[model samples]
Target: MKMISIGQLAKRTGASVRALRHYEQSGLLDAIRQDNGYRLFDESAVQFVERIRVLLRNGFTLDEIRPVASMLAPQPPDLRTVCADVIALYHDKLDELDQRIAALMEIRASAGARLAFLEEQRRRGGP
Candidate 1:
């Protein structure tokens, strides 16, 4: 029945206290209340916060995360559906990254070509 305050949680989780508060506001985390109006979180909350960090890093939108997090509630499992959704999301993000990379490569090539042409023009005397 051990619990920790917000500062302690932040120290343990390596997340800012502001971020923890935001997570609570986002319904991604919950805290118990002490009689003095202090917020207390169980040790398990550390793991939950880490999971949230992982999801965010993986490009999971907050809204999309809601449905996935629903699986972690005190209920029956829905892992298969969550896995499928995560796979699709990953594919979409990867495709977006690929397109971005291609655009950057094209821009770089164009810049290189322009520089080469300018160098050649300069070599031919200012024209």
Candidate 2:
């Protein structure tokens, strides 16, 4: 099997070495430790790294991307191969985001109200 150094992988994939290391740390990618302590990776690592980048770009967090990232390793997912677990995950994420949005909207409204009250007090020269 063909293998390459992390630097080569990063260069070929247009990812920084730091980013590659981050991916490894996040468990989104893997590499082999050589005797000299250099990290090496299979040719397919390019595909996995690219998949991770695409998933992350689409707003999937590292934890959320793990399973989906491996679904079609070395290849991209296809609609035909879509499964229930992945679908459920998307639904869960959407639900989570909705809850967060509602909370943030409430905070925003509260802040706006306080700002308006302070501005009014300033205008009226009230203590």
Candidate 3:
């Protein structure tokens, strides 16, 4: 069993040291303290951190990933059920993103309209 130091793990995973510490603090990654008080991680941590990074890149919050992270633990309950729950979470996130896009579109349209009106007024010599 090869144990990697926190700095090595961060380098291998392309995550900043601060981010790795944040992940540990957020309960996303687990690390062990060496006798010398240095943080060490198992090789398995690389995969876990990669998964976390993927989720975050895809707009999943740490809160949203918590359940999924738990499911990835050594002994998880009912994988099928976990998959279903994760799918439901994705659906909810998708719905929220859709609503946000709709609102942004509305704002964009309003801004465009205002811009056009202002341009027309300027063309007509109005302040």
List pairs with backbone clashes in candidate 2. Answer: none
Comparison by TM-score, 1 against 3, better one: 3
Sort every candidate by TM-score, greatest first. 3, 2, 1
- Residue pairs of candidate 3 with colliding backbone atoms: none
Model 1 quality (TM-score) = 0.71
What is the per-residue lDDT of model 2 for residues 1-127, given as tens digits with 9 covering 90 to 100?
9999999999988889999998888887888998998899999998778877776676678888777766636544444476677778779888988999999999999999999999999999986
The Cα RMSD in angstroms, rounded to one decimal, for candidate 1 relative to the true structure is 3.6
Pick by TM-score: which candidate is best? 3
- The CA lDDT at 7 in model 3 is 91
Q: lDDT tens digits, residues 1-127, model 1?
A: 7799999999987889998888888888899988998889987788778777777887666666766664443323553345676666668778978998999999999999999999999999977
> What's the count of clashing pairs in each model shown?
0, 0, 0
Candidate 3: 10-residue stretch with minimal lDDT:
73-82
* lDDT, candidate 3, 38-113, per-residue tens: 8999888887888788888889999999887865544334543546777887898899999999999999999999
- lDDT score, residue 118, model 2? 96
* Alpha-carbon RMSD of each model: 3.6, 2.7, 3.0
Q: Alpha carbon lDDT of residue 12, candidate 2?
A: 89
Task: Give the alpha-carbon lDDT of every model.
Answer: 0.78, 0.83, 0.85
